[model samples]
Structure formats: C-alpha cells, structure tokens
Target: MKTGTVVGRLWASKRLPELPAGALIEVQLDHPRDVIVCYDPMGCGEGERVLITIGAPAAWWFLPGQQRVVVDALIIGSLDEGSPPTMPK
Candidate 1:
C-alpha cells in the first residue's frame, strides 16, 4: 500500500467495459512529486489524504488470487483531520 493525496479528478466517459465504475482521481504519491490517476470507490476528493494500493497487490489484497494488473490500483481509504500517525515527516 502507498500513501498519497488526491490532487485532482479525471473525466473519461468512454473506457473499457472491464473497468469498474468509480472516480478516476489524480493522486500525488507521498514519495516523489509524481501524480497518478487512481480509481476511487471510497469517495475521496481533492486535498483529501488517501491510502492507495497500486498494481497487482491492489488486486490480490482482496481475495481469490485476483490479477493485480487487471485490478491494478485502488483508493483504499481517506484520512480525516489529522496527519497519519505512520506517515513520515
């Protein structure tokens, strides 16, 4: 799992049918200044701190040995008012 913050949202009305129905948000990964579009079903929004599971781990983390590439990424959770206790300074 990776820690990040929602930087913005993307609107793609046309996509593959295999994709899940959710918001495609741009998240600023905690490490580098890089931003990535992540699928969010948890309703996270801009400026909201979030937990993201990327690639394959994001899939198998669920169950039944799901393919990580197919279910490549997800916004797992959103943080409230405080900084995450486990987050580095």
Candidate 2:
C-alpha cells in the first residue's frame, strides 16, 4: 500500500457497469510526489491522508462476487493525523 493525501474529487457522468458504487478521488503521493486518481468507498474528503492499493489487489478487494472491475488504484484506508512510525537508522 502507498500513502497519500486526498487532493480532489472527479465526477463522471458515465462509468462501466462492472464498477462498484464509490467516488473517484485524486491523491498526491508522499514519495515520488505524484498525483493519481483512486476509487474510494470510504467517502474520504479532501486534505485527508489515505492508504491506497493498486493493480490486481485493488480490483479483487474492492469488487464483490466474482465479477471484474477496472480499478487501477483503490483507497483502502484513511490515515490519522500524525507522523507515521519510523524505522531504525
């Protein structure tokens, strides 16, 4: 999983039938300083830090039954306010 902050939301008039019920949010990644859109089911708002899962894991975890969903990235968890624990140097 990767950590990022929710920057904004995307509105689409049309979406695939296979897609689940959720919102599409733009996230700014902590490392590499990149922005990406992710499927969000937790109703995360802007400025909230989130944890994202990508690729097959995201698709499988978010989808119900045995159907396939076109999810390149999915918001798995919302982060709390505070710095994460650091590893030993």
Stretches of model 2 off by over 4 angstroms after superposition: 63-66, 84-89
Q: What are the per-residue Cα lDDT tens digits for candidate 2 across 1-89?
A: 88888999998778877766679899988876899999998999998989999889888875477477888899989987885533346
Worst 10 residues of 2 by lDDT: 80-89
Q: What are the lDDT scores of the predictions, listed in order?
A: 0.76, 0.84
* TM-score for each predicted model, relative to the true structure: 0.76, 0.84
- For candidate 1, the lDDT comes to 0.76
**Deviation in Å, model 2, residue 56 alpha carbon:** 0.5
| Model 1 spans with C-alpha error above 4 angstroms | 60-69, 84-89
Write model 1 residue lDDT over 1-89, tens digit each, in one string.
Answer: 77888889998788775565668899988876589888787888678999888887666654663232355778888876786436455
lDDT of 2 at 12: 78
